[model samples]
Target: MSNKKQKMDPRVMRTRQLLRDALVELIDERGYEKITVQDITERATLNRATFYLHYSDKLDLLYQSTKEILNDLLNNLNVTFEDKVEFDFSKDADEPHDTFMHLFEQISLNSKLYKVFLTEKDIPYFFSGLKKIIIDFISNGINFTQPDDKKLTVPRELAVRYFAAAFLEVIVWWLENDMPYSPKFMATQLMRITVKGPYLEHPFGK
Candidate 1:
């Protein structure tokens, strides 16, 4: 992050934003199938060379935009819980709930980018990136003590997968309905169900 890069000229930033905005607008208006690099460049008032300089292809641009948005979220986040937060269908913390709301606020602000990422063909890796974020957060937040407890039967992997899948489902639903509910409301709803699970006991607690 050089000073020059950080303080990119307003013109350059404006061009980049134009390119992204153009692509998103095109995708919304006509869908990805009918969109082309030339369409995006023409809409942005930039040439093909400029489009290439910013992104490799439409798919690349889509994913890059998503990655940039997610990076912005992860870098700015501050999730705090009181204890070893198990990656389970349990919800208990106000702070983590607040943090999730913040993340979704970021997501809501860029819903078009998300819709394109989710519905676009040949982009399972986008979901994988979302999973990785949850897994990484859970792994880092929960400290295991055993020397060989990498597989401590905490069901960490499955839990991470569950959270990712469930959360994404909510997000997709939100996008489909044009996000009628606030992000915080949706997140709090999720947290209540998820965090309440671990406290309940079954016959074998399975």
Candidate 2:
């Protein structure tokens, strides 16, 4: 963050948080379409100008807060991965499974925010964020591989899109079904299918 954003006062932070909380609550009670900037301000006990200073509109606030949630998720993942002493996936796959479950747990803890993300009104931003993360991961992974043929191939982008789409679909299904399965179990099953490439022909081929 820049100095401008970092230099906010504690009071200002409190007010912003209040507005965000109020907005989520309002959306839960009613719906995003029916909620207005005035409603958020009134619920937060803040002025319209204050709301404007923080956000141009409700969607902007939603995007900003969701980004924060993503950043926190990434930070927690980094912490989990960094603390590991060994990095053997076949032998130490449980760590990744646990990490993924932790991510699900984080999302579950904030079901309201995720409910908004799963909704048609706000799903685009969530998918966009997921796409960006998958793109970066696949890009870096491809960069580390030496091409076998004369031409340079970058099919990892396609692979990333495929994987992210599948992942998002699974998440949306879980959310829509009220997440009957625990995150740990869901992560275990997904990790198996992903790492093992299914039980049949092997997705990546031997």
lDDT of all predictions = 0.68, 0.67
Candidate 1's clash total is: 6
Candidate 1 off by > 4 Å: 1-5, 29-33, 56-60, 80-96, 138-154, 197-206
- How does candidate 1 fare on TM-score? 0.72
In Å, residue 201's CA in model 2 sits off its true spot by 10
Give the Cα error of residue 144 in candidate 2, in Å: 7.7
Q: Against the hidden reference, what TM-scores do the models get?
A: 0.72, 0.69
- Best candidate according to lDDT: 1
TM-score of 2: 0.69
Global lDDT of model 2: 0.67
| Candidate 2 lDDT by residue in tens digits, 23-98 | 7888777877888999988998888998998899988887787777677565555434334435454655444544
Full-model lDDT, candidate 1: 0.68
